[model samples]
Target: MMSILKADLLKVKRKWFWLLVFLGPFGVIALQLVNYGVRYDYLMQQEPDVWAGLLDNINMFVAPALLLGMTILASQIAAIEHQQSSWKQLLSLPVQRGYVFLSKLAVAAIMIFISSTLLFIGTVFFGIGLHFGLDIPFLAVIKNSYYPFFAGIPILCLQVWLSVVMQNQAFPLAAGVFGAVFSMTAAFAAPDWIPWKWPLLVGEHDPIWYAVAGMITGSVILIAGLMDFVRREVLT
Candidate 1:
């Protein structure tokens, strides 16, 4: 298990992965700047309450960025293994498939979590610099942020499984894009039955019910993915 984890870490340490990590935060910053620019005149006219503006920023921009980043990170985790034929080589070792799958999943989840947190921090500080000119209370931002991060775990796990089993990066990425789109659609269209609502929508004024539902649904999906990953055949 240690060796498997080490190998996974080594894969994540490669140049391409670091580049993605670096670029991910900058992408979030760019998006925030665009949003600020587009809405600045209106925002200043209204002079909306600071909390409201902060929440709006999170809902309109930060949540989607985190979800997209997690999707890309999760896809890359399994895609890299398949691309380098490391999956086949790892299977040749006398290790349990469950261990291998879990290790990879852990590495991916940890990396995504760290990256998302950093992106959130970066966006908040950027806003401070541009808007308020001072770092203010971020408790509301931090509190509201937990739902999406935790809610996304199941989606991340499922994406990892898809990337591992599908052998085609394009399909998984396309699916992720669809998921992001569907999340917004579901928020307004069905609202009740759309499981995608939990992980993709964030910064709601009242999100208790959605947060609880997200936790339950995310757990179910994660467990199902783990079972499938452990039992599925690895064909080199």
Candidate 2:
């Protein structure tokens, strides 16, 4: 598993992986800048508490940007193998299929995790720049920012699974877009059972439960994806 992960890292060493990591968070922040720029006074009036308003603005865009990032990251990582038909070579190796699948999944999660961290950073940087004061809502920042990540694990797993299982990259990427849209809709109205909306469901009631559910569901889906991968035959 360690060796496989090492190889995956090296494989992405020269790719535009870092750009994907930053794009989602930066995009979200930029949108907020335009939003707040145009209506700084009006938005502040909406919240009475400017810090809360700033955080609210930041959180509003975090989930969608995160889902979109996961979609692209999954396709890009899987494309590394699909484009060159390298899956056959990978599976042909002595390593178990689970390790290969797990390593790839971990890389997918890590990329999104880094993107989430950047989301937090961008939020804080701009919040300060706006003179929201030094007394920032640090806990709210961490929870709202990172909570979406925990809830997003299952989506990351699904995205990776689809990208790996489908022969055409477009299918998996499109599935991701569909899921993202569903999640956005689910955000406004849907039960928690809809795994598509988990990212938005976080902290709606009990954050701990949401986090736990994400971990359990994501693990199951990942293992299921690996088992499926092992059962199927990769074509040359």
Q: Which stretches of candidate 1 lie over 4 Å from their true place?
A: 131-135, 200-205, 208-212
Q: Per-prediction count of colliding residue pairs?
A: 0, 0
**Model 2 lDDT-worst window of ten:** 201-210
Mind sharing the TM-score for model 2? 0.94
Question: What is candidate 1's CA lDDT for residue 159?
Answer: 75
* Candidate 2 accuracy as lDDT: 0.82
Whole-model Cα lDDT per candidate? 0.68, 0.82
> Ten consecutive residues with minimal summed lDDT in candidate 1?
199-208
* Residue lDDT tens for model 2, 1-236: 99999999899989998887888888889998899889977898799888777776776677677888888888888888988888999999999888988898988888888888888888889989998889888888887778888878888888898888886888888888887777767867778777777777443667556666878898898888888988988833
lDDT of 1 by residue, 1-236 (tens): 88888888887886476566657667867776787778877765675575457555655554455556667877888877777877777777899887887787788777766766776687578767776746555766665555566666667777777777777789888888787776665556655546566654543535655557666776787678778877767744
Over 4 Å off, model 2: 202-204
Top candidate by TM-score: 2
Candidate 1's error at 43, in angstroms? 0.8
